[model samples]
Target chain A: MTSTTAPVDASTTNRTVRLASRPTGEPSAENFRIADEPLPTPGDGEVLLRTIYLSLDPYMRGRMSDAESYAAPVPVDGVMEGGTVCEVVESRSEALEPGDIVLAYGGWQTYVVAPANQVRRLDPTRAPISTAVGVLGMPGFTAYAGLLEIGKPQAGETVVVAAASGPVGSAVGQIAMVKGARAVGIAGGPEKCAHVKDELGFDAVIDHRDPEFKAKLKEATPDGIDVYFENVGGKVFDAVLPRMNTYGRIPLCGLVSQYNLTRLPDGPNRVPSVMQRILTKSLTVRGFIQNEFVKAHYKQFQADMAQWIADGAVRYREDVVEGLDNAPEAFLGMLRGTNFGKLVIQVGADPTQSA
Target chain B: MTSTTAPVDASTTNRTVRLASRPTGEPSAENFRIADEPLPTPGDGEVLLRTIYLSLDPYMRGRMSDAESYAAPVPVDGVMEGGTVCEVVESRSEALEPGDIVLAYGGWQTYVVAPANQVRRLDPTRAPISTAVGVLGMPGFTAYAGLLEIGKPQAGETVVVAAASGPVGSAVGQIAMVKGARAVGIAGGPEKCAHVKDELGFDAVIDHRDPEFKAKLKEATPDGIDVYFENVGGKVFDAVLPRMNTYGRIPLCGLVSQYNLTRLPDGPNRVPSVMQRILTKSLTVRGFIQNEFVKAHYKQFQADMAQWIADGAVRYREDVVEGLDNAPEAFLGMLRGTNFGKLVIQVGADPTQSA
Candidate 1:
């Protein structure tokens, strides 16, 4: 292996954003604490990585809460956990070298010392390194595996996805289209809806904010929905549910809308009605996290997604936040539907983009 | 061809129960109008049958209302629709001979004419002819298909079913035991619970009516539930939900508890919470009607269920309400959970029982 490079930063410190406290409702800046610590020294077979991009996803909100989940919650005082595209600044492993761009769980930090084996090296020439945290990463695999394995959208069937301008939903819609299924997207505003339909090639896009959103969704999906990629659950799910055709399949990936809520909304508990609907329609609602299907579908997803990107069959958009300091606000904005596309925090300089 | 047998009924008229009006909540005697019409002649390819037993099931409640469902609702003033075990009194087709025992959708009528091709002949020698609508029929098939196809209870896993003394739930629990999975039954009364545990051979039984019902269920399913055959969906479901293990499969067949309710229960709408639990646990909640799998698994079900019954590995119970006039009350009682096991209206003389 090439000799390890000296620390590149003039400041011999690493900055991190830690979870100061768990939020009761929507997370605020008070929930996070930014601090500087001595630069971590790499142990044997470990690499020091400088964060280039930090993914801000809806699932991150789940990690912030202490609720029971598929994965453990990010503890208070711990560095806010997230996927990151990093550049290996110093390496002490045969597997990685200095200046190697790799994918790592570097979180909301300027630097992370990760075992070399834990990070997968990214070839910058193949694609922009930022994609290691966006279109070609966890979110993309989430769309691929959940949609295909659970949703199983058949050709000519309608597949509806909410948050259609975001990473997972955008990929879900595009992949549904790839499988010859009609892709109807649900996004918040006119701009995002337009991006979803025109730029992303979705057959139809509904503005969930519009008063006539449900009507528009109904009009868009004339034959009824066969597959629903459920990343957003709240009013959008309420609207899409009645339109589900017999034997419809819903891949429940995330409940982004419910994540921030302090308590359940008052109601005549509609669980019975929902269960009745499922019974009558013979619907399949399966919840899954991306990690469950990684072993079976990750390689295929990479190859197929790469080909789709190259063939112009699948397109993606990125909403890049400028710095680590802006990550909390950007993440909050994402939860509030202010951000569009794959929301990413550009924590540091991107060498690949510069090239 | 065998000669046609004279109509066995003493009266020249067909006595029928018609849906007089839709029930607002609980069905009453007034909802059913018992009427008589002149015996009709069989047309070509039709056979006139004297109903022996009419299957009174939870699904018939759905057919009572005008609500949209998989099958059309029974129109007011129309003969109440049901599955029937019948004896052919008159045959106008070569496929069926007079005195042949057959299964048909003969509705809640003493005597009716049905197309010969639409009915399947049942040999009384193989088992009791009433088994066509009980242990060997729709409810049995429902338990088989929903459990194996959707619930997919793996060996050593826990499989739970409500209404455990009833046809569907009893079969579901027994079949789980046959598959080397632990079977946990939830029933209302101590007698039914005892029957479920001692007679049906379920691994454990919980009395759903007990004050400590939920606690008992939790204790019974220490390993957590992997498969839940959901036929009774109100409080039992609420109790079962928290006990579901990660990747738990729920094959939703019916909502017997909620069937008679006029409106949803007051709540901080729990739909979001349910969806959240589903997402976090990677649960599979599927709604299915037994007929969905009839095409794919019917033959196998027939062979397997028959063998299991013959081997004494599966046991069943029938709550037979004698006389056609008692059917309306019996059906209503079934919705109230008063009837134990498979509720059947003994419409006419059972020739097979005599044999």
Candidate 2:
């Protein structure tokens, strides 16, 4: 894998998705636009890459809005940010060469140029290169860091997670099981619930959309919940709070259910119940981003996750939406809980398959 | 103060306050009634005590209701439970002698008997004997354990506490100051707020009842709140939540404002905001009771608190009600923020002052 036909010269050809306007609620196709720009050139200590797989996650909805958040939102007319598995097309740094596969923050573009030090080189022989954008990438790291650092699940403890079929929630349940805790997953509809329990090997699964959701959740957690890895907040959270055990820990990763919520649920406020449950049960509810723990936990996460995949102790599924033109629709579907698993866009043909 | 004279016998008579009925909400005088019982006799391993000071705290409100809580509710016709500064009237064990001041769970009674080992003898020279039930006692330990152990207020961080004129809140603000953090107190009125800032030496004070409470809180916390010692969670908590900085810590200890609420605050549940704020700001909201830290941090609390009071680094105020008969009314007032500081019923004359 040396210099491949002079790098295809992306300097005159680039397709990108830029934010047209912020959404009032759930994002629509009108909020994004397809644009073309002269491809950027690699500067000193940098590499130009062509994206092969673009990952779409629930958090991207947050980046599309100008809300006060842990990270800044994408400015109007700017490229929508995303994680990508890319092949180095042009290299100016000693650390890398053309044809190398690596992970990059390439946004929703077909090509990008970034500092060589910022991307991690990937080995295709060890695992699928596309996983660098899914289970084995940012989403996996999100579950790993949040559960271990904040959730601290112990043996025999009941750990419940909503959005259980998604990348983060699936890993959370499996990792909890590896730690000897009972894993209970909550997903929408029976199909997703069945997949979570039978395929993911969770101890139990409950359908959040069921009319008897609260009763089913109570039945699933006989000893009450000791850890709730919160990815979906709203009705799911309201039901889980009363069921938490004394000294329970809630590692809140994302509130996907409320991401597009324009208004809160109508009723008598539940703040008193939250405060009471916290005090009476001595529960810990901590919200965190994966980057905060990367320095301390990333190395361990990669090693453990790789071995888990190799040994069949852990498994993953990818919902690969085809073409760069379909990314906006796929991203919107992922937020509405339509994606079956880790959602990613097949941006370009994989050159590694020919090797 | 040793066994200088014979113990006064109360074997033939006793005066006590017993729960007449559980209140629907905000316990009234009718819910409590005066009663007489034959003074309890010390058994082989128990000691007889004469109640000198009865400490009334917000937790008693929880015990007076039938609602499930961390601890059991007071049964009808049972003497209301409380922490009391007492004198050993009769000793059956060698650990304590008559005339020694001690801290005991003596309830609302003139005379009672407890296991000798359950009561700890108090040295008058350590501080005032009354303080054994006030600043140097349970309330002090609550503040010390919750702030240092859970809140973990760092130097230059802004720490805020509500009910700032009370024993727990005052100690919380002062201890935060001692830890090199900026302290802000929130009380009910100008008088209590003034005492919290001017007398207790808090860096700033805000009255939660002010019409511009949210604005005032924002002004007081320029860097945003890093640690919130939550004791009176309701409107104060609502106003403070949005102002919290990223990675903020909330040690939820009590909710005095909601203790008397027959119903929750009206409409459009604010739970969504709580979840969203928690996720976006990467906050840590932990609920706890002082007893949880007793095994790990109790010994250190006694040493540090004594040294603090000795060096004039900590000071306390006592809103001493004159008689045991007035306890129910004073307790009710305290819940409404009418009582200023550590409310205690002076059940009997101080035995140490006579010495």
**Docking quality (DockQ) for each candidate:** 0.85, 0.79
Residue-level lDDT of model 2, residues B67-179, one tens digit each, is 87899999998999999999888999999899988899999989889999999888887788888877888899899988998889999999999999999999999999999
User: Quick one: best lDDT, which candidate?
Assistant: 1
Candidate 1, residues A1-355: lDDT per residue as tens digits?
Answer: 1111344453577888888889999888888887777899999999999999999988889888888888899999999999999999999999999999999998999999999999999999998788878889999999999999999989999999998999999999999999999999999888998898789989999998899888898999999999999988989998899999999999999988889889889988999999999999999999998999999889999999999999999898999999887888898899999998899999989988754
Ten contiguous residues with the weakest lDDT in model 2 chain A: A1-10
Cα lDDT for residue B235, model 2?
85
lDDT of 1 by residue, B30-102 (tens): 8998877789799999999999999999999999999899999999999999999999999999999988999
Name the docking class for model 2: medium
Lowest-sum lDDT 10-residue window in model 1 chain B: B1-10
Q: Can you list the residue pairs that collide in candidate 2?
A: none
lDDT of 2 at B189: 91
